[model samples]
Target chain A: MILATSLAIAAMFAAGAYLMLKRDLIRLIAGMILIGNAANLFIMASGLRRGAAPILPLDEPTADPLVQAMVLTAIVISFATAALALALVYRVYISHYSVDLSRLSAAEEQQAERDEPMTEDLRESVRDDTDGEASPDGRHAREAAIR
Target chain B: MIAVPIAVLWFGGFVLAVLDGTRKPAAWLSVAVLTSAILSTMALGITVYQDGPMSLAVGGWSLGVGITLRVDMLSIVFALLSQGVLLAALIYEVVNGVGARIYPAVVLFMGLGLTGLVFTGDAFNFYVFFEISMISAYVLVSYGESPRQFRAAFVFITVNLLGSVFFLIGISAIYHTTGFLDMYRIRDQMPLVQENPAILSATIIFVAFSIKLGLFPFHFWLPAVYTGTRPSVAAILSGALANIGTYGLIRFGADIFPRELRQAAPVLIALGTASIIYGAIQALSRHATNEVLAYSAIGQVGYILIALGIGGPAGYAAAVLYTVLNSTNKALLFLSGSLRGWLAGAAFAIGAFSVAGVPPASGFLGKMALFQVGIAEDRPMLVALIFLGGALSFVYMFQLYRRRTAEIEAHGSSPWGAQVVVVMLALVILGIGVWPDPLLNLVERAALSLPEAQVP
Candidate 1:
């Protein structure tokens, strides 16, 4: 039983690592969920004895109920984190219209470009070059900001 | 008495979570909650410092069998550090303007988490509270609701969750080997356990904290998240959140795994050196304020690691002192980096000076502590490395100041309230630097909490 539990944990970790390396946002969350479960199982597997249930009227030696409680807590925490990750990924998808990390980081670079200047100096130069009406770049900037 | 801070945070955080914290009154309430927690922690610290360690078993369960909440000099110092930092960040954010509805509540939750983790004697409770803090941090990272923030959030969560899993594994391994989840009992049984398993779990736990600290090889996510978030969030991450790493390392390494720590001292020093050089060099090359500070954050933690690596009472004291100073400097820098006034510039300079280990700033005291350790240990090379690291930091901090000066000319000064907060943090650092005896005495006592650090 111990050997089988160890193998299962190993397989889950391996798969989690593989998925975590992928670019897809959902797959990364899936990877986190898997690794989190593996950790939970690892906690459960820490109980060495296979014995009767921990109850009010104990006839014999019981399994370690502490590990059971720990695994439950671990599951709740992991579930909360995974749910947050899903919500965050969905937000990213809606904003960039793609789930790829490359796209999200591309948005980051664009934001960097937008923030690079827009200071007094750059604003002065852009104002000097453009007419009073909205320039193409100005319109594009507004659209991007709204988006 | 030990549970006052934890209970206050619990009820306060629960009440604050439902309120819209972007409003003025709610934000002030959150600040009030954090302040009370800080006061209670300090009050507890006085008791712990004068008397000794205190423990409470929840539900009146037996000490070894039931969950335990323990407070000693070490835990109280950390609890106070985390609470004080959260208070500063919360006030800074409130004064500047809270952007999110949940910002204040999340900060309170994080305070609760840090408080709980440091005070818990049970390993599993530590994990639970650690996750609470990390979960709030995820929300804090995405504060801006921008695509950039989303990317940062994604990276931060994924990377840190992996670290958490590694920590969980280490705890389970400890339990499997020792049949105890209570840290005191585990420590008692650890020697009887075979060497190999203990070392493996120790290394895993170290890796977990190293990742959290953004130590050398695992620092890829740090700059991105630190730069991507707002200044206040960045401060909380570095100032309040990073304590988990420092406190965990000292708690787990020096207290729980002394043998493993001694065995790995050389490796810790090597890694510390790499982190220092790499962080300073990278920070020097970076142009943006946040980015440079991010890299500098990576570099400063190296000193803490080295102090922990040194492994004596003095070494442990140095680790505690430097961590306190480092977190304060980080809080001041990140908070002041966004402000525009001349006062903000002074605040930033004080933070930078502290980082570079200059006099009249708490950071200098931290550096001196390490220097004392180096001299006491009689490793001349270590002293030279400290000197070199300090020089490199001075260059980068000077460069950052020069750049900030240029920008200060272009922008008007910020609000007095915000500037006041920054200046207040600067004063704390300066106060400690000028009169280091109190903090020094406190840290020495905190060090003796660990069996290995018998200072004198």
Candidate 2:
């Protein structure tokens, strides 16, 4: 049982880490849940013992009830965090229409660019600064530079 | 009693949660609740200082069996600091007019979490309170619900949730090894634990707090969150939320894992120095006022870590004093930075001076305490680092002040009466700086509460 629990924890944590590294917001939250579960399992496995239930009149060795209680509390906290994360992600989707982290950031950069109070003439001047590096064969690149 | 403030905040928060926080009556009620909570916390501090630490084990269970709530000078000082910041932020928001209905309740809930975290003697209970505060912070971070705030909230929640996981793992490891959930009992058992596991848990716990403090290696999430949020929320985050990092470091490192702390002092000092340099250089280059203050916060926490690395009664006191002074200064700056007018400008200037460690402000006393720590440790390098950090802060702060005052001159001042609130906060910081004796004695007494860190 101990070996199995340890293996499970390792697998869950590895999976969580992998998911967390992904660029999608949904996967990131899934990763959080997985890691949270792994922590909960760790707390439970930390106090494992072959014993009877911890109740009023236990004649045999009892399991560590404290760890069980703590795990339960941790689970509740993680659940709330996940719920909150989902809500925030939904809000993000509403505003940006995307769940991809990289895309979201790119949009934010564009918005920041738009928010800047630059005159069209100043922008043209700045764009002209990069004219030397503009690709000769690429119309898209030239247009982007001109803009 | 220690429970009084927690109870007041908890019940007040519950009652306030149901009412409309945007209404004047509800806002005034929150102010009243916060006032009572602050008074109770002060009373608790007085009682604990006069008598030693006061403790209560829930349900009358024997030692190590039930959850314990303990309040000593250390807890009360942090409690007062956090609550004071919350109160000021709450009033500032109220005076400006609350935009959201849940703002008052959320601030009260945060107060409950901070007070409970400070007063708890149980390890698990600490995590519970920590979560309470973090969850409230998550909501508060998105209070404006703007695109910038949403992105900030996402980053804040994601990074902080990871930190929370690390903290939980450390707590479980400690419990598995020590076989006790009570912090005092764990401290007693810590010396007997194997060095490898103890070190593992200590490292995990340290990383968790360092992430929260926005120390050099773990500070990626701080600047974005601080700059993206509204100013009062920023004040709350910097002033109240960040206290968890300092308090956790002091309590966990100084008390529970003294041996590990001593072993890691060199690493602490190195990381702290990096944080100082990195934060200062970033602040100097940043043009936005809030962004500069955010990076400056990253720099200020380094002083706390450096003091902790210096470890002794004097060093611990220095850490505590610096944490208190820095929280007030940050709150003042973030608050006043949002307001316009001459009074707000003066408040921001005082806050800027405080950060730069000028006299006639509380920040100078904090710097003096750190200087004493460096001298006592006979580390001239540390003294030199402090001097350089101060010089960098002075330059950035001067730039921020000049830009802000110039903006105020161009535009008219802020709404009526808000500047008065900010100037009053500045006066408090200046008052403490001028009359440093009482605050110094309190911090010294708080430091003595920690178990002595054995010198290597």
Candidate 3:
């Protein structure tokens, strides 16, 4: 039983990690769920003991109930987290018309693009100064220099 | 008496959650709740200082069976710090008028969450309260309802969830090894555990917190979130939310896993050095106020890590003091940087100077504490690094201040109430720097709360 549970947890974690590497928002969320469940399973496995249920009258060695309670709490937290993630993804899709992480990054990339002209003008001026002081032909005058 | 702070926050948070936070009355009501929570926390702190750590078992269960609500000097200090920052940010947001309907309620819940997590003695309960705060933060990140904010929220949520998982795994491992869920019991049982599992769990917990702290290696999500969020949210993130990482590290590392912390000191110092240098360079290269401050936040946390690495009474005291002062500095900077007018600019300059470790600001004392630790430890390289980091910060902060001054006329003036909050925060920073002895003793006393780190 222990071997099976451990293998199952490892497999879930592996698949979850693989999915988390994808750019698709839905896939990323799926990966989150998978890994969350894996952690829950691992928690359960941590306190494994084959015995009677922990109930009122104790006549024998009982299985640890604490890990079970912890797993349940973790499950609820992750459920809420997944729900929040899904809502955020929907909001992103509404705003950007896409669920891809790369697509979401395009807006930021464009903002950076808007700042490029200033840097380019500075680089050109610096290169002009280098031509006067040292040699423009000098290698490594400024790696940022425009040709 | 033990549960008053959490009770006020939790009940207040729920009642406020149903109201429109954008309404003026609701906003002030939330403020009232937070103020009351702060007062109660201070009352608790007074009793704690007079006597000793106070504790309560929920439902009156025996030691290990039921969850514990522990209020030690360390937790009280953190609770006060978190609640104070939240109040400042809340009032600032309210004075500016909340844009979102849920802002005030979310901030209240964040207060409750921070207070709960710090006060809890059970590991699992800590995770539960940690989630409460993180979820509030997730909502807070997207407060502006813009594409930029949503994108930033996505990055923040995804990365931090992984950190949460790491923390959960570490807790489970600790339980498996120690056979106890309560922190005090776990601390007692930890040393008897085998070296391998103890070190493994400790390392996992360390990585989890370092991610939260946005140290050198795990800092990718920070700049995006801080830049995307509003100023009040940024202040809360750095000043209030980041305390989780600091407090968690001190509590779990120095308190529970002293041997492991001793073993990991070199790694902590190395990472701290890397974080300081990386953050400084990044801040220097950035032109945006939020971007520079984001990177600066990363840099400042490095000093706290270095202090933690030093260990013992002085090291722990230095870490606690630096965190408190750093929180105030960050809150003041974020709040003041967002406002316009000459007064706001002066406030920003004060924050900038404090960050740069100049005199008559709380930040200088934080630096002095770390420097004293280095001198006592006789590590000249550490001393040199602190000086170097301070020089780098000063240059970048001067650049930011000059830019703010130049752009003062470009934008319209902000609200006076908000500016007043910024100035008040600045005054607190200055006041602390002027009278460091009491704050120093408070932090030293807080550090002495740890079992092995008592000062002679």
- lDDT (10s digit) by residue, model 3, range B1-456: 879999999988898889989999999999999999999999999999999999999999988899999998999999999999999999999999999989998999999889999999999899999999999999999898888889888898998998899999999999999888899999999999999999999999999899889998999889888888889999999999999999999999988899999999999999999999999999985767888899999999999999999999999999999999989889989888878987788888889989999989889998999999999999999999999999999988887776668678799888899999899889988999898888888898899999978634
Best by DockQ: 3
Q: For residues B1-456, write the lDDT of model 2, one tens digit per residue.
A: 778899999999999999999999999899899999999999888888899889998788888888999898899999999999999999998998999999999999999999999999999899999999999999999998888889989999999999999999999999998998899999999999999999999999999999989999899899889988989999999999999999999999999999999999999999999999999999985656788899999999999999999999999999999999999999999999878888898899999999999989889998899898899879999999999999999988986776667678888888766788888899999999899898999998899888673332
Q: Which candidate model has the greater DockQ, 1 or 3?
A: 3
Candidate 3 Cα misplacement greater than 4 A, ranges: A1-4, A56-61, A113-147
Candidate 2 per-residue lDDT, tens place, A64-147, comes to 888889999999999999999999999999977888999877866765455332533224434665645656667877777689
Listed for each candidate, the true contacts retained, as a fraction, are 0.80, 0.73, 0.64
Q: Please, what are the lDDT tens digits per residue for candidate 1 over residues B180-288?
A: 8889998888888899999999999999999999999889899989988988889999998999999999999987898899999999999998998899899875667
lDDT agreement with native, every candidate: 0.89, 0.91, 0.90
Candidate 1, clashing residue pairs?
A: none
DockQ for all models: 0.44, 0.40, 0.46
Compute the DockQ of candidate 2. Answer: 0.40
Best by TM-score: 3
lDDT of 3 at B157: 92
Residue B189's lDDT in candidate 1: 86
Model 3 chain A poorest ten-residue lDDT run: A115-124
What interface RMSD does every candidate have?
Answer: 2.0, 2.2, 1.8
